[model samples]
Target: MSTAWAGGTDAILERMEQMTSLFVEETRKSMYKGESATHCEECGEEIPESRRLAIPCKYCVDCQTALEKGSK
Candidate 1:
């Protein structure tokens, strides 16, 4: 490989690393925190205890899926 091509590859890798770090920081800031709800806030369905223990979720699995789809 040419010397110039090697240098360009290193620059590209450094830029990719910077972009990945920024994305990780943003995702960390947006993650759910605090206590998990016992019931689905949207559908009023009872959220299972297992679900509550699994993650800090405010809605049931079904409702969460619908909300994600609608957002897109």
Candidate 2:
């Protein structure tokens, strides 16, 4: 009934929505944990004191930053 997606924009938007949902879920999971020194659960890197003080359980600021960039 429509031809809007003939250019691939629909596919791109669908993928973006999926990725956004996944990002939101993971972020909620991390932020809802306890108030302990956040350590990168994936890489064992020590999250900075500033980050923990602000977020409560960030764990590995660098790794998280990299992951966020990769997602973009």
Query: Which structure among the candidates has the greatest lDDT?
Result: 1
Clashing pairs in 2: 38-59, 39-59
lDDT of 1 at 5: 80
Candidate 1: residue pairs that collide:
none
TM match of model 1 to true structure = 0.60
How large is the C-alpha RMSD of every model relative to the true structure?
4.3, 6.4
Local distance difference test values of all predictions, in order: 0.85, 0.75
lDDT of 2 by residue, 7-70 (tens): 7887899999999999999988777577856577768888778877777665476667777689
In terms of TM-score, which candidate is strongest?
Answer: 1
Model 2: CA > 4 A from native: 1-31
lDDT (Cα) of model 1: 0.85
* Tens-place lDDT digits, model 1, residues 1-72: 567786589789999999999998878556666788888999899999999998878899999899879962
In model 2, which range of ten residues has the least summed lDDT?
Answer: 55-64
